[model samples]
Target: MEIKVNDIAVDISGRKVFSNVSFEMKKGEMVAITGPSGCGKTTLLNCLGMIKTVDYGKIMINGKNVTKYKDKEKTKFWHDYATFIYQDYGIIEDASVAYNVTLDKYKMNSDKVQKILKKVGLEGRNNELAIVLSGGEKQRIGIARAIFKNATVIYADEPTASLDVKNRELVIELLRQCAKKGAIVVLATHDERLVNECDRIIDMNQF
Candidate 1:
């Protein structure tokens, strides 16, 4: 789906963040949102994922206004269309990798989960618990979760921030794989290497 953020203005706790921000993202396009810390890059992403409400704006997805969705309707919209990868790798620590990847998809089989785990270079680790995995492995589990969902858009917030060089490259490549498969990939990041590799860049400071 194509995403358009029109004349958006946002404030958090009486502090102005983004103002009159607007952008258009095409399907299969990988766009990077870059700015200094606290510049509202993540906030813009949250708004895109419908995780945060903008004080004023219209979010159009495939020509439909999603900004006005009711709370329950917004939940449904997020379930099927978008996936957000947080920087901290929000995997369930006690759950096995397989369980974390499958999430709420009860019908998904072990084979499918294992296959995607392998795709993210986490083969044979599905039986391992999330807390036992290294920082990189946990990030891989997050990638596997998004892939299994086959989401239309992936909104990632500082996905490579906490990793070392090698793991950072791994995460960037995984996101590129998502874009190659025709998903709109939007990343809020400070990593120059990642920004250089993306298909487009959105400078949130323009807001």
Candidate 2:
């Protein structure tokens, strides 16, 4: 899938957060959004993921203008085309790892779940409850879920924040592998090591 953002703008409480932000993202590519704190990287990610609408300009995905998608279409787009990995490592603390990874999707392939768990180095932990995991393990599960979804695009926010040096490299490698499998992987991060691995970098401060 291809994503194009043309002259998109967002404002918060009458203050402009970003203006004329434009870019093109596509499958098999990795792009990093980087900037100082409060530079609207998260806001831009929200817009791209269809979690929020642009105040002005256009957002197109696979030739469909997402700004004009109906509510039903928006829901379907999110369900089948994109998934997000949040900075807070969004996971259900009381749920089993398998439940957290598959959510409510009853038809999800169990082998695929195992494949993703193995990628995150959490191979035999499927039945374990999330609350017992350390912060790094929880974050790896978040990455696993993103990988398992196999969405057209993966929007990740500071995905390496909770990982150690070795796991950080491992997680980033997994995200790159997602792109290699034809998913556009876009991330908002401050880690120079991670950002350096991206195919391209968009500096939010330049907007």
Candidate 3:
């Protein structure tokens, strides 16, 4: 689950979003990407996660240069080795929690879904519609989904943007445990409280 970003650069519409970025982290490490608005914090995460390709330099995951991998190989790596916890909840508003966790019955049985729900503190809310859950609960569902997938790298973009103190703590703790479990957890956020607890903070504005 090691990640290495060397001289990474990105541009949009002839405007440079970020350039000459370099950093490295190993498994069990949690890194927070933080900076002012439009500083490319989220963009860097996308690049590292292979959602967005870089204009220059290389992104290495577990010693393999992702930029060099074929399209199909990259797609397979993204699906099987990485997971993203989107800020907008990334859940089906009309679907049940169990359905969102497993997507289809083949991924995980009802029993396994319940166990995952319990791990995220959603134990008995399996049958509840995603729309009925609060923002914090929805975030928990995203974490639960990530846990279910068991990806080696987890990317969370402002996962606690609109949550109260308690919920924010819960979200941060869940992400922390992901790192402790030997997954590389990277999150983009403006929350100082969350940033302070990370193993390292990569301030995009530094570039």
Candidate 4:
């Protein structure tokens, strides 16, 4: 899979968030979006993830322009090929870890859930409530969901912003593993450690 952005730009309420940004990402690659706060890092990620629209230029996936994809098309793209991991963990706080990962999409069989959980170091915590887990564990659950979905593109926004040193390293390792498995991982982060682990960096301040 491939994602290409050519001279893309975005504006909100007459204020330009970013413009003339271009980059390409391939499968099995991890790219970092870096810059100071308010420099449009998240906005750029949103554009790439199809959560926001660009006012100029084009975004192409596999050589087809997706910048102007219809809502239905965008929804299908998200459902079939992409997933997001947010700083907040993005799982149902009151739900069981198994439920958060499968969400009834996959059968609630123990072996299936356990295998996925084990990948993120939550091996036997499937029955535990997400609300009871630590922040690092919660983030692992988020990564577990992405792995379960077998998503091709992963967008992580400040995934390690709230973690301590050990958990931050763990999250970084998991994201790297995803890329190694042929997924495109794009993350927005201020963590220099995370930045150094990426294959490439898109510094928004340079745009």
**Best TM-score among the predictions, by candidate number:** 4
Off by over 4 Å in 2: 105-109
What does candidate 4's lDDT look like per residue over 101-181, in tens digits?
Answer: 878835655586789888888888888888999999999988888898899999999999989999999999999999999
* Weakest ten-residue segment in model 2 by summed lDDT: 104-113
Q: Please write out the lDDT profile of model 3 over residues 25-140, one tens digit for every residue.
A: 88999899999999999999899888898999999888889977788997899778888889998999998888888677565456778888988888888878899999999999
* Candidate 2 per-residue C-alpha lDDT over 116-146 given as tens digits, one digit per residue, 9 for 90 to 100: 8877888888888899987778877876777
Report the lDDT of model 2 for residue 172.
Answer: 84
Query: Would you list the rank order by TM-score, best first?
Result: 4, 3, 1, 2
After superposing candidate 4 on the true structure, give the runs of residues whose Cα lies further than 4 Å from its correct spot. Answer: none
TM-score of 4: 0.97
Worst 10 residues of 1 by lDDT: 103-112
Return the lDDT, model 2, position 30. 91
Tell me the spans in candidate 1 whose CA falls farther than 4 Å from its real position.
Answer: 105-109
* lDDT (Cα atoms) of all candidates against the true structure: 0.87, 0.86, 0.89, 0.91
Residues forming the 10-long window of minimal summed lDDT in candidate 3: 102-111
Indicate whether candidate 2 or candidate 4 has the larger lDDT: 4
User: Tens digits of per-residue lDDT for model 1 on 1-207?
Assistant: 898989998998899998988889998889999999999998888888878888997999999888888899888877888788888998899988888888854734567787898899988887777899888888878888889889879988888888988888998899999998999999999999999989989897787
Question: Which residue pairs come into collision in candidate 3?
Answer: none
Displacement of the residue 70 alpha carbon in candidate 4, Å: 1.2
When 3 and 4 are scored with TM-score, the better candidate is 4
TM-score of 1: 0.95
